[model samples]
Target: MLLKIDVASTVPLYQQIHDQIILGLASGQLQPDEALPAVRQLADELAVNMLTVAKGYNLLKAEGYLISDRRQGTRVAANFQADAVFMQALQEQLHQLTAAAKIRGLDVKDVQELVAAQYQSFEGE
Candidate 1:
């Protein structure tokens, strides 16, 4: 899998990395049991601090998206319960979207249609 980082954005580098990793897993770009780049290796490759990559991996581990050990280094969590992960992420996005839509006078039907249309673009990808 390829990981990209943009430094100028308001989001922290580590957060951006972590979010993309989660997105990758959700989209099945990275399979369960896939090995992740070591913190030092990724940091060197990305030209970012090692601590940043470590922080991202730590957060993923804490969230059960990654399992790390000294010998294995780090790998995607073996628990491939896609339904739970995808739905949880979807629900979190919905919560944020709902708050924004409320301020803009949009409702559930509008959000539902928007999501359905967007998801259609991902069919069989």
Candidate 2:
């Protein structure tokens, strides 16, 4: 998987990394049991500090999207589940996105069509 960092963005480097990783997982670009790059390696590639990469990795681990061990390194969780907390957070994000769409004069059907297209795009991939 390829990861990119936007140095000038308002989002923190670690967060941008974390978000991309999450999207990869959700979109099936990163598969279960897949090995992730070593923190040092990823940091070097992204031109960021090791600690920054570690922070993102730790967050993913805590969120149950990744598993890390000395012998196996870090891999995507083999059996991941989106628990109540995760669902709630996801719902809030969707609400915010839909609200923005509405403010931009997108009707409910327009938003639904966009959502459907995005969901189908993932399936085609």
Candidate 3:
């Protein structure tokens, strides 16, 4: 997967990496059981610190989006389920985003359309 990191953005490098990987999975650019580069290798390719890559990988592993073993190195988890904890967090985030959209003068239909467009983009990918 190709990760594009914006050095000028306020977001941290590791977060960019983490978010991009998730996007890749959502877009089908990454598949279940797909192997990922080693920490050192990805760090070198991204011209970032190895620790940064490891931190992102570790977070994904902890979140059950990835798995690591000596035999397979690091690979996408073969199965991932959105448990209640994740669902709650997602609902909270959506609530915040919807509130922000309302404050910005976006009607419900506008927000729904925007959401549909984004969802369709993922589907097309």
Candidate 4:
């Protein structure tokens, strides 16, 4: 897992970590039984404090996306799927994208065309 941290971004460091893990989960990059890097190790890799990684892990744990066991270490939660809240969050992000695109002068038709092209390109791969 390669994690690139942008310390200057407005997004909180913990959220960057959280979102990356969520993407990893969705893309099947992280397996259910896989042990995550120790929080300290992840901090070292990202050159951030252990607390940042721990905070992200805690959030994921609370959301039932991962589980932390002292003996077995931290692993993804088996059979986990996005809940209603997660889906709503995703929808909100999509809305933000559309709003931003419109603000940048992308008309509705242009936006739809762009999305269609991108969707087709994605499926082609």
lDDT of 2 by residue, 1-125 (tens): 89988999999988998999988987889999999999999999999999999999999998898999999999999997778989998899999999999899999999999999988977876
**16-121 in candidate 1: lDDT tens per residue?**
8899998888677988999999999999999999999999999888788999888998999989564787789878988998899989998889988888876765
Task: Please give the clash total of every predicted structure, in order.
Answer: 0, 0, 0, 0
| Model 1 lDDT at residue 89 | 82
Which residue pairs of candidate 3 clash? none
Better of 1 and 3 by lDDT: 3
Ranking by TM-score: 3, 2, 1, 4
Over 4 Å off in model 3, which ranges?
none
Q: In model 3, how large is the Cα lDDT of residue 83?
A: 94
The candidate 3 region of ten consecutive residues with least summed lDDT is 80-89
For candidate 3, the per-residue lDDT at 8 reads 91
Candidate number with the higher TM-score (2 or 4)? 2
Better of 1 and 2 by lDDT: 2
lDDT per residue, candidate 4, 19-61, as tens digits?
A: 8987777666777877888898899999999999999999999
lDDT of each: 0.88, 0.92, 0.94, 0.86
